[model samples]
Target: MSASPRARRMTGAQAGAVTARILSAAVGGYALAYAATAFLSVYLPMERPDRVSFASLASFFVWVATILYVFAARSAWRATWVPLALSLLLGLAAFLPGGYGVRP
Candidate 1:
């Protein structure tokens, strides 16, 4: 039988990787989800209320998927950087060129 979690010892690298996955799933995933929601809200061609609702709904899935990806990634570094990069890209897409600040 396999050892219990408390009985099993993790190496420093294993612990660090787990920590990175957790942080990436929480913080990075939220950032990515927020960015995706913003981008979708701006670009989805629905009416305002419908667009917002759809984007909000989609963001939940995005967050869950990010969490899964973070844990499933081959390396902690990949998990960390991929979501961060995607969030930045999505944020830029959402905020740039649309003059989003001046909406009446």
Candidate 2:
């Protein structure tokens, strides 16, 4: 269903907020998962330190920054080019590299 007439018009600012919210949720989930993985790598006994997933913690930090995107998306936040770009770059850096993956 289309939006109501009253809701028909959405300014760029308003749209940005909604986008931010969605991004926030997605990034937050990523961060949590990364953190959990990183936690196990650090405290858990590891026979080989070389097997540690070094990138996982860095990925967590990048994902955490997505909160700004989420905030902008959910609450009609203005569309800022810099934050969006940063988020994308960070996401790629964190997700594209296999530096964070560890397998049994």
Candidate 3:
């Protein structure tokens, strides 16, 4: 079936595949940062990542990618949806300046 504009742009199966890609990418990115932090922590704790630019940016991208990929899989990916919803709620609050949090 064709995807509805209001409905996600991907089919359920496609969504699942996309989620896998997103997860893999996220894991790879995190591992890279983790290794960087591990090596750098020895010389500088603050520079390790919690407040650094690249760390925060990577985290933000990971979050966005996860959300998009997960939500796209909502049709057949019931198992992956709960976390997506929670993330959406938190994202709503965090973004949009002072916008209200998402309601269930």
Best by lDDT: 1
Tell me the TM-score of each prediction against the true structure: 0.87, 0.34, 0.28
Off-target runs (Cα >4 Å) in candidate 1 are 1-7, 100-104
Q: Report residue 62 deviation for candidate 3 (angstroms).
A: 10
Candidate 1 accuracy as lDDT: 0.94
Give lDDT tens digits, candidate 2, residues 1-104.
87777776778976766666665457554654455445444444555463255545545554656444445452433334434555455445544454657333
Clashing residue pairs in all predictions, respectively, total: 0, 9, 0
For model 2, which pairs clash? 17-72, 17-73, 17-74, 18-73, 19-73, 20-69, 20-70, 20-73, 21-73
lDDT of each: 0.94, 0.51, 0.48
Tens digits of lDDT, candidate 1, 3-104: 877897889999999999999999999999999999999888889899999999999999999999999999999999999999999998888857757432
> How would you encode candidate 3's per-residue C-alpha lDDT over 1-104 as one tens digit per residue?
97667885668878766666566446533443344433233333454455355544555555555555554554434425444454455444344333444421
Question: Which candidate has the highest TM-score of all?
Answer: 1
Candidate 1, residue 57: the lDDT equals 98
Q: lDDT, candidate 2, residue 35?
A: 50
